[model samples]
Target: MKLLRAIGHLIITIFLTALTQVGGLIWLLVLLLASKFKLKKRYLFPMVYLVFNLLLVPPVAKYFGREQLPVFDKDLKPRHYLYPLLFRNYVVPEMKTLLEQSAEHLKYQSIGITYLDANFPFLDGFPLLPHLSHSDGKKIDLSFQYVNSKHQPTDKKPSLSGYGVFALSEQNFTSNSCIENGYWQYDYSKYLTFGTINDLNFDSKNTKLLIQELLKYPSAQKLFIEPHLKQSLGLGHMDKIRFHGCQAVRHDDHIHLQIR
Candidate 1:
């Protein structure tokens, strides 16, 4: 099975190479659409420019002064140093400000949030695996705020695994609950095995507060959630909040916020 999977990946690599092998045209296109602030993949430039990213430079400096905002540097934090490079740039000032404010609010309340992705500094398309629409640096994916089954804030676990879009019915509803080693491991009965983090139950109230907190940002455009979850939140009729529907990953693992 491992050999077959390797063969499959090799085929995919060849296919993408051929598809994007338009050579100069593809490179030029990405350049033309390049963000004025974000340091996109320097595909054509020397790789040495990336050396600074390993230094002690502030998050904002990663953009190399293109004026991009570093929303969150999860990988740069000491405990998370070993994780993949999941941080990226946020270009909208209003969105940036709101995110800072929201993070502060969560911190003040002893709540936590783990960001997963934003625009890849490469293309404005979901060419990257596992995402369908993170292009253009306008969207962000985040682990939902968690609470004990009692709906009270709890310190986020050492690993941000098991957080995802989950049905309220799957939870044990109790006004008093204790956070165990981990909530049920994310159910891979449906989503790809990679999305095993989907079992982390979100505190409905806190998750709703998070969505509301984001909407407070003037640039907030839409919040993609499950239909049932949206209906439960009383946002089913709202214009800016839409359901990602069953056609997509259950999204119980994360929330997608897009800004204008």
Candidate 2:
């Protein structure tokens, strides 16, 4: 009876270990497939469920250890780094340009940018999506930082640059009031452009100048500033240019640029 009980315990341990391996593989597969197919939005639910199970299942957690999953502290601070694809060099120069332009315009400044994912990789938890991640590459997100007169970030307005801004609801982009009522206000200090807005009104003259300058760069091939900005500069669309939707309309918080 003693021997039989020992054997039973061994079998249970082996089975649990195998299950954990399978679960880990599935989670990996989900990430691989989603990236390859660009199916993140489509597979979001299943991926979230898999992440939850990997984090919450007792046997799996014990076998793989909680530390193996994306690390979070008791206060839910992320300890793990996202894979480097999020910060490819192809995208960094454009980001720098936007940031520099924004900084030049602001007297007191704190800025954060991010992509639209739950991971919130950059800041502690502030959500902001980079425009380069969108299909068009023109939509970018930027947020103001509250700073002292000397331009130092204060506790009240923390630095969000590493993390990003988070609140991007579909309604923020699709509502009629978004543009008509200036619900999406443009900050000359932190300028961002979407593909819409072809109306060439003088109100957006400064934004047009920025777009003109951006177009002179070789990297502009990957960007799609607003239509009005392009038209104001008297430039036609290049075949390589593409446009993407701004999932959120309000540029008051973060600038959304569409690539075209």
Candidate 3:
């Protein structure tokens, strides 16, 4: 079964790679025509980056470093299914190692990570919905390990909404977010955060350990979590642990770890 699944994933990935090539060419042609009419040169490089990916070299372009995105380790189960095929979970070597090490540590506690947005295979400017800073493949969202009232590990995913302390009773997975479907609008209201009340809440020890593990990586740049969480965890470093601060969506359910 494992062999069959691996073969299936490979086939689908190859198909998507071909599709990206075609899509990149189409975008390039459109951009070229737009450029002929003396359109702004601003979007030129970004468009070229997309085209380069669609061409023979679909993973890296001059806009980005030569190091292409690496496929994630199978141990990290994706909270969102299409993430694997869409290549949104790819990461640099350093980040991947950090996550692997983190996973190893979490396994002793019987916990796992929920992988989220990486970036489109080729486009830097191309938007990956429900995110503002993930276009560069350096940013990733992951669910906090949820624990029961006794603080024991549970089968549940992350929880909490909006503010961490204030949003104890709310849930976030109400979104129509799914793969194997056509176009659909995103339900931005659904999200998880710390301080989720009732039978389930974010485990402080596990969450703190996750953050500490991420910070261990030398390439680690910043961590975007809610303000209240930093205080609750007694993590007061302004340099690394920065607050997203109501700029876009509330990151209560997941922490955004970005690397240099």
The sequence of per-residue lDDT tens digits that candidate 2 reaches over residues 129-184 is: 33224322233432222334554443222222322221222323333343555635
lDDT of 1 by residue, 74-185 (tens): 3111113212233243334455566667877766555555555544444344343345666566776665666655655654531333333354634322201212323232
The list of candidate 1 runs beyond 4 A from truth reads: 1-52, 55-94, 149-151, 155-165, 169-200
Give residue 90's error in model 3 in angstroms: 2.2
TM-score of each: 0.57, 0.26, 0.58
Would you give me the overall lDDT of model 2?
A: 0.33
Evaluation by TM-score, superior candidate among 2 and 3: 3
- Model 1, position 204: C-alpha lDDT score: 67
lDDT per residue (tens digit) for residues 25-67 in model 3: 5444545666688765346644654554445353444345323
Question: If ranked by lDDT, best first, what sequence of candidates would result?
Answer: 3, 1, 2
Model 2 residue 50 lDDT?
52
Local distance difference test, per candidate? 0.50, 0.33, 0.58
Q: Tell me the deviation in Å of residue 174 in model 1.
A: 26
Best by lDDT: 3
Mark the 10 consecutive residues where model 2 has the least summed lDDT: 116-125
TM-score of 3: 0.58
